[model samples]
Target: MQKESVIKVEHITKTFGLTKALTDVSLEIGYGEIRGLIGENGSGKSTLASMIVGTGHPDSGEMWYRGEKHNPKNMLESKEKKINILIQENGTINGLTVAENMFLGKESTFSKSGNVNKRRLIEEGSKALARIGAGHINAADRIEKLSFEDRKLVEVAVAMYNEPEVLFVDETTTALSQKGRELIYKLMDEMREAGKTIVFISHDMAELERMCDSISVLRDGHFVGTLQKEEITQDTLKRMMIGRELTGDYYRGDYEMSYQEEVVLEVDNVTWGETVQDISFQLHKGEILGLGGLTECGMHELCKIIFGAIKPDSGSVHLTDGTKITSPSSAIKSKIAYMPKDRDLESLFLATSIKDNIVMASMDKIKKGFFIPPRAEKELADEHAGKLEVKMQNTSQYVRELSGGNKQKVVVAKWMANGSEILLMDCPTRGIDIGVKAAIYRLMEQLKKEGKSIIMVSEEMPELLGMSDRIIVMKDGKQTGEFERSEVLSEHDLIHAML
Candidate 1:
C-alpha cells in the first residue's frame, strides 16, 4: 500500500546559465519512506535535491509540502519549516567546535542573558554524538582537529538531531567507514519508523537497493521513471538511468593475470604519529593493489605518505632506482601521480579552464622556450579530453561547472597526460555513477597493460573485489590479512578481516 504523499514536485524546470539541469521533471515523495535519487553525473540529482532543501530554487516549478505551497528562501528557513539536509560536502566550520557547529543558526535555547552557555552546549552535542554511535569523539574538540570521517559523523549526527519532517542525504556514505555507515542506516530506519520522509542521493546502486523504498531515476536532466521497492534491480536501474542496456563486465574480467616480479615501489617500516605504525608494502610493475579497511584504519593517510604529500616520521618510500620521495614535487618529477580524495581542493583548480587544467601537469613537456603556445596546449588538452570521453562544451570551459564524474575525468586525464607510471588513488570512484566507474576501471586496465602500477585505496568492497588482483586489509593501524582476489573471495571475508 502507498503511504500518504508529503512532497509533490510539479513540472520542475531549472537552468543554470546555458545548462538545463532539470527539464519538466516531476516526482512525489511520501511520508514514512526513503526515496532514492540516482543518475549519471550531470543528470540533475543534486540540483533537484537542492531545490527541495532550499539551497537553490528552481527556475520554473511549484512544490507542495503537506498540501501547502513549499517555497523556502534559504536553508535556515527550510529548517524552520521542519526540513533538513545532510549535504555531500563537510558543512561544518573548521574553526568552530562540534558543539558550536551543531547549534549554529539556532543557539537561542542555549543563550542565557544574551550569552551562550558553552557547558550546556557541549552536553547536548555529546548526547547527539553518542546517539549516532560516535561517543569516542569529543564535542568540545575543534572541527579542524577531527579526522575527515569523524567530521562526517558529526555532520550526520547534527542533521539527524533536529527530528525534521523531511531529510535529504546526498553522497554522504562514500567517505564513511562501515561502522559510520551502520549508524546512518540505523538512523534512517528509525526515521522511517517515526514517519519522517528521506530523499537519499547516492551513486552506489547496491546501497540504494538496500536502503530505498522507492527509486527515482533521471537522465540528461529529464525524469525517466520511478521504481517500486520490488522492482529495483541492478540491470533494471542501469537501463533506466542510461536509457539502454549496458554491456560489458563492470570490472576487469581477467583472473589469471601476470605481473612483473620487479617491485616498482616500496614502503619500508613506515610510521607516522599514531595513525600509521610500522607499515610496509611493495607494489610491483603493472599491479593493481587494493587497500581495504574502515575509514580510520590509516590507509587514506598512508596514500598521502606514499605519494610524498605527507612525510612519515621515521621511514621511507623508495622507487625502483632508489630515489627517495620526500615531497609531492619530487614524486611528480619521478613520474608518480596521486589522485587525492578531496578532488575539489587537492586535485584541480576549480576556477581554471578545462584546457589549462588538462595541460597544467604536463607543462614541462609543452613549453616552447619558457612559453607554451595556446594552440599546442589546446591540441594536447583536446586530445586527452577526447581520449577520456570527457563531456564538456569546449576545452576552455571551467572545470568547476562540470559534474562530479567529469571533474574526476579531468583529474585523471591531467595526470595521465603527465606521463606518470605510478598511480596513487584514494576513493577514485567514491561518488561517481556506474558508467564512470566502468570507464575508470577500463583506464586502469589500459594503464596496467602499459606496465603502470596502481595502489588504490577505496571503501567500496565490490569495487575492490572486482578490480584488484590482491587485497590487503588494515585494522587500527595494523595489517590483519591479505588475500588474492579470486572467485571465492567474499565481502564477508573482507569484513571479518577489517573488523
Candidate 2:
C-alpha cells in the first residue's frame, strides 16, 4: 500500500535578524500519523512548526499539502484550510465567556437576521465541550473563574471545534491533570482514526513514546534524524537531540550531603480552603525536599502559601532558629528565594537586559553607599552567567532574546547570586532541554554543598526520585506518602499516592 503524505516540509530555512533559527529542515508527516517533534530548546523544533502554520516564513523552502504547494500567508489562511495550532501558553481571554471565546471569529454564523442566537451558541459550545470530555465547564462562565488546567481544556476545545485536519499541539500537556491528559490523548486517537495528522511537541518522553507513531529530532537549528516506533528509545532520542552519547540518567546523582539537625522551615496545621487541610511538613538545613502530585493536588498552592504569594487561611512558617517569616517581602529579607512554575508569568523580566534581571535580586550586593556601581553589577552578572553557562552575545541583551533553557538558567543565577539560603523551586525545568536540565540538577547539588536548603515542587517523577533527599506526595491538599532517598520509589508507587 502506498502511504499518503499529509504534510511535506522540504528544505526549510528560517533566519531571525542575525540568528539562523532553522536550517535545511525537511520532514514528512503522513496522513493519520501523530508525529513527535523532539528537540532541545533553540533547536528549531518550534521554528519548523511555526513555518508550517504560517506564523513564520521560511527564508527558502517549500511546504506541500495534499500534492499541492501550500504557502499560507498567515494563521487565518492556515485555519481556512483546517490547519490549527495550540501554542504552549494559554490564548484565552480571561474576561470573556467560554462560548464567546470558542466561537470568537465565527459569531456572525450564530445570528439570524442580525439577531444573535444565544441558545444555539451555548448548545454548539456544549457539544464541542462534550466531544473533548470537558462538558462540566459552563459555556457562559467567564474564563477567569476556571483553573489553569480547565483553561487549557477550553483552549483544546476551541481547536477541536474548528475540526482541523492537521493539528499542532506544542507543550500543552504540562498544565493538564492525568485525567485531562487522557482526554486529550483519546481525542488525538479519534482524530487519527478519522485520517487527521498531528504534530505533537512535549517535554515528557513517556507521553511522546506512547502517542507518537514516528519521531523526528532536531539539534542546533538542523534536523538530526527521524525514527520509527521500534527504533525510538529514551536514550536514543536523547542522544539524537543532543548530538552525543548521553551517559547516566539525566536525574542521576548521589545526594550524600546531610542537613543540620535544626529545622530550616516548618509548616504547621496549614489550611487553604478545602483543597488543603491540616498539612504539616518540615525542611532541614541543606536538604532538598520534593513535593509530587497531580495538578490539582494542592502542591502548587502550598508552595505559593509558604512563599507568601498566597496568604494561608491558617498555619505559620517558622525558620531554623524559631524565627517567623510572614510575607514574601519578609521571606526575601530573611534570605529565602522562590522560583515559580510559570517562568514566563512569575520569573524573568522579558523587556529587561539579562544583567539587569540577574542583578535585580542582588541590588543590595551591587549598591555601594547610596548609589549602584555599574562595574560591580557587571562583575556580579558576568560571574554568575559564566558559572551557569548562559549562552548570550552579551549580558546587556534582553532576556526575551535568549532560548527557554538559557532564560531559566538566568533565573537560577539571579537567586544564587543573591545568596539565598532556602530556595523554593516550582517546576524549575518545565520547558527546558535535557542538557539544561542536567545542568540544573548539578546546580542543585552545588547549592546543597554550600549548605543551602531547597523545597522543590515538580511533576516529573524521575526528577523527584533522582534529586531529593526525601519525597512527599500530596493528594487533594494533604500529605499522602513520604519516601526517603533509599526507598527507591517507582513511578507506579508515586502515581498511586498522587491519585
Candidate 3:
C-alpha cells in the first residue's frame, strides 16, 4: 500500500554562520504518522524541526506541507497553515492563569466590546482541557501553582487547542510522569486518528519504538537514514544514530575500589513536605549509590535534600568527617557537588563562555587571597575542558553553542576541578548521546578511583544497574527496596519497587 505523504523535505540545508546545522537532509512523514527523529545533541534534529515550523529557514532546498510547497517566512505564517511546535523550553507566562495561557492570543475572542469576558474564557479553556483529557486542572489556577509536569500538560493543551495539522513534540516526555506520558500517548493516537502528523523527538528509544511508525536517524547535521518499525531495534538505532557499535556496559565497569566502611554522609529520617517522608540513607567514602524510582517516587526531592537545594522540615544530614552542614553553601564548603537534573535551568550559565562556566564552581581555586588570578583561571579551565573532551572551537565560546552532551561535560568538569568528594547527579545522562554517555561513565570510574563518592539518581533502569555498587529504589517518598550490584536484580524488580 502506498502511504500518503503529509510533509516532505527535499534537500533541506540550514547553516548558522559557519556551522552547518542541517546538510541537504531529505525526509517524509505520512499523514497521521508519528515519526521519531533520533540523534545526539546538536545533530540537527531540533534545527530540522525549527525549519519545518518556520522558526528557522533552510539555506537551500524546500519543504512541502500536504500537497503545497511551503516557504513559511515566520512562525505566524506557519501557524496560519496549521503547523505548530512545542519546544523543549517552557513558553508559558508564569503570571497568567492556566486558562489564560491555554487561550493566550485567542482570548480576544472572549472580548465583549473590547472588555475581556473572563467567564467565557475560563469556560472555553475548561472545555479545551477536557478535550485533551486534562480536565483535572483548574482553569483559574495560576501557572506557577502547578508542578513542572502540569505546566508541560498545559503546553500540550495549548498546542492541541490550536488543532494543528502537524505537531512537533521535542523531548517533552522526560518531565512527565508515567500517567502523564500515557495521557500524551493517548492524545497522539487521537490526533493521528484525526489525520494529524507528529514529529516526536525523545531520548527514550523504547518510547520511540512504541509510538513511531518510522524512525529517522540524524548525525552531525546530516540525515543518516530512515527505518520502518520492523527494520529497527534499539541497538541498531543507536548504531545508526551514532555511527558506531556501543560496547562495554552502559554504567560503571568492574572495579576493586573499596570505601572505608565508615559512613561519610547520613540523612536521618528526612522529611520534605509531602513529597519526601521519613527518608533515610547513608553514603560511605568512595561509594557510588544509585537511586531509582518512578517520577513521583521522591528520588528527585531526595537528591535536592541531599544537595541542600531544599531544606528538610525534619531530620538532619551530617558529614562523617565530623563537619555539620545545613545549607547548599555549607555543602559546597564541605566539598560536595550537585549536578542538577535540569542542566539548562539549574547547572549551566547558558549565555556565558564555556571557560567561565567551568570555573564558576571553584573560584577560590584560582584566587590569591581575595584577588582572582585570570591567568590561573584560564589555565585551569583549559586543562579541565581538554580532560573532559569537550568539543568546542575555543574555551571562550559561549556554552549555549555547545551540544547537550558537551554542556553536561562542562558541568562535570566544573565540580571535578573543585575537587568535590561527594557528587549528587540527577539524571546526568538525560538527552546526551551514547558517545558522551560512555565518556561520563568512564569519568565516574575515574572519580571512584580518586575516592569521590557519587550518589546517582537516574530514570534509566540499565544505568542504575550498571553504574552503582548498590541501588536503592523509592516509592511514595519511602525506600521500598535495595539491591547490591552482585545481586543481579532485573528491571522488573526495580519497576515494581518504584511503583
List per-prediction Cα lDDT, in the order shown. 0.88, 0.86, 0.86
Better of 2 and 3 by lDDT: 2
**How many clashes in each candidate?**
0, 0, 1
Estimate, for each residue in 1-499, the C-alpha lDDT of model 1 and write its tens digit.
Answer: 1237899899999987777899999889999999999999989999888887888899898988888888889888888878988866667887899999888977889998999999999999999999888999999999889977788889888887887899888888877767777788888999999999899989877789999999999999999999999999989999998988996477888765457898999999999988888888889999999998988898999999998989899989999789999999999998999999978768889899999999998989999999989999999999999999998888888997788899999999998889999999899997899889889999999999999999999887888888887888888887888888688889999999998
Would you estimate the TM-scores of all the predictions?
A: 0.92, 0.92, 0.93
Per-residue error for 2 in candidate 3, Å, reads 11
Q: Report lDDT (Cα) of residue 331, candidate 1.
A: 93
lDDT of predicted model 2 = 0.86
Q: Cα deviation in Å at residue 21, candidate 3?
A: 1.7
After superposition, the stretches of candidate 3 with alpha carbons farther than 4 Å from their true spots are 1-3, 255-258, 369-371
TM-score of 1: 0.92
Tell me which residue pairs clash in candidate 2. none
State which candidate has the highest TM-score: 3
